[model samples]
Target: MRALVLDRPGTCDTLRPAELPTPLPGPGRVRVRVEACGLNPSDYQRAAYGIPEWEWPAILGLDVVGLVDTLGEGVTAVGLGQRVAFHGDIRERGGFADYALADATVLAPVPDGLEPARAAALPSAGLTAHQAVVRRLRVGKDDTVLVTGGAGGVGGFAVQLAARAGARVIATEAAHNTDHVKRLGADAVIDFRGEDIAARVRELTDGRGVDAVVDTIGSDSATANLGLLVHGGGLAAVAGRPDLNAVAPFGLAPSVHEIALGAAYLLGDHRSRVQLSIMLAELLEMAADGRLDPMLSRTVPFEDVPGALVELSGRQVRGKIVYVAS
Candidate 1:
């Protein structure tokens, strides 16, 4: 199979063409024909963070929607020709290929009425959002949640989920995305570039602060986000660790999370499968009903993966960049 393998992890061009034998399913694995794949921040982070070194010839993908072309022995759940999506195995090449094998344990039947590109965009970002709000924090009715980077991939989903869970949402975004983010169900939005996010949350909550703070962007915003949460409230940072003491002065002990997508999907149990199913159902239902929109910025052919990723590293994107396998 032709895959955009990380021949050498130096630059995007290093992710050149490579001929690798098509992968076959092991006892419980299923071989999938790649259709569409979504790029995540981790994709670039992996390359820059010195993870997928060239000597390894790694494939850079973790989430995809594809057709099950073959199934390994004893894999009784999914069948051949079934269109499904999941967080592809991290131990192997990512979704940047024509054919890749997936573990049936993490695979979910694509919800009816969902498009492959759309579905592909959900697994990584959507799963992160679901983990932070639905599983970790468990945002419930009447909760007030503040999601930083509200228009971002994970933040967009977080805003929607938190709102859908009956939480009053105050999201932080750039000036231009304020309205765009709010339509996703945020009750209020602050321009991180223009407004004081911490103060905005306080104002929205009438000095009480939000119940949970989900920061999809960190390295700069994590510490401040902690201060926006109420005492004893939770703070989930998808990017990095936050200063717990930022909320300590307020009596709030923030719970920080550094999302490990691999662990979330491969937690040797039914936990990953159950969560994957539920999030897919909710996101697909919202999309099918026009209540959810991905704000997809663009689509690139499989061959353009390298070039596309270069631009993605700029951190100027408005939404998901989908790579459609053709």
Candidate 2:
């Protein structure tokens, strides 16, 4: 099998194509003949910063859509040649290759007629947004929600989902992305670079603040947005941890949710891991029915994986990028 192998913990330039023995599935696993793989910031983050537990020579595509080629023992849930999609475990070899491995329990069937690249784009970003907006924030009718980094992969989906749920969505983006975020159903778009997000959001909501905030760009953004929540409102942090101390003086009964999408797999929690599949299934259904946009903005050939990762690392790409297998 041909794979873009990471020789060591380094930049995307270190990724090189090489021929390696195809891996066989262990019990409860299946081999995926990769059709498409989505590019994500985490791909470059892992390549550059490296995970403490991950071994060297890693493959870094996490969101995968492919056909199940071979199933291992006890893997009766999925069949050979079945098309499926899943967010791959980051600790293992990923979908930036001709083939990849996936746990049968985490495989979600890709609906027929849904493009592989579109399905591939949904596993990670879409799932994170779904978990943040739908599960954690519980955004609903008449609620006003704010999404930081609204043009980003996770943030874009969050804006759309919140809007679909009848929430008045406010999104923060650069000036250039104002129209893009608005097209994604954001009722109000704030220029994060030029304006004060909290003030703008407060003004948009008539100084009441939003009912919930989905913070995709974390660190200071998370902490600042925490103060933008109404009393009893929720803040779902996808990137970094918010400083609880920052909001202590306010007496705002704020709900803070730490969203780590991979924690379910990392903790060896079978139930939560299975929930990944369930989430992907629902997301796929939404995409198939035209209710959700996968927002796949670019599709490149398989060999462009490394360059695409480099591009993704630059943080200028507006939407999801997927590399299709030839």
- lDDT of each structure? 0.79, 0.90
Off by over 4 Å in 1: 50-55, 265-274, 289-291
Clashes of 2: 0
lDDT of candidate 2 over 141-174, digit per residue (tens): 9799989888999999999999999999999999
Q: What digit string (tens of lDDT, one per residue) describes model 1 on residues 206-301?
A: 898878888887746888777666667887878878766555463565666666566654464567665665666566667767776766778899
Candidate 2 backbone collisions, by pair: none
Q: Please report, as a residue range, the 10-residue window in candidate 2 with the lowest summed lDDT.
A: 48-57
Error of 1 at 191 (Å): 1.3
True lDDT of residue 182, candidate 2 = 94
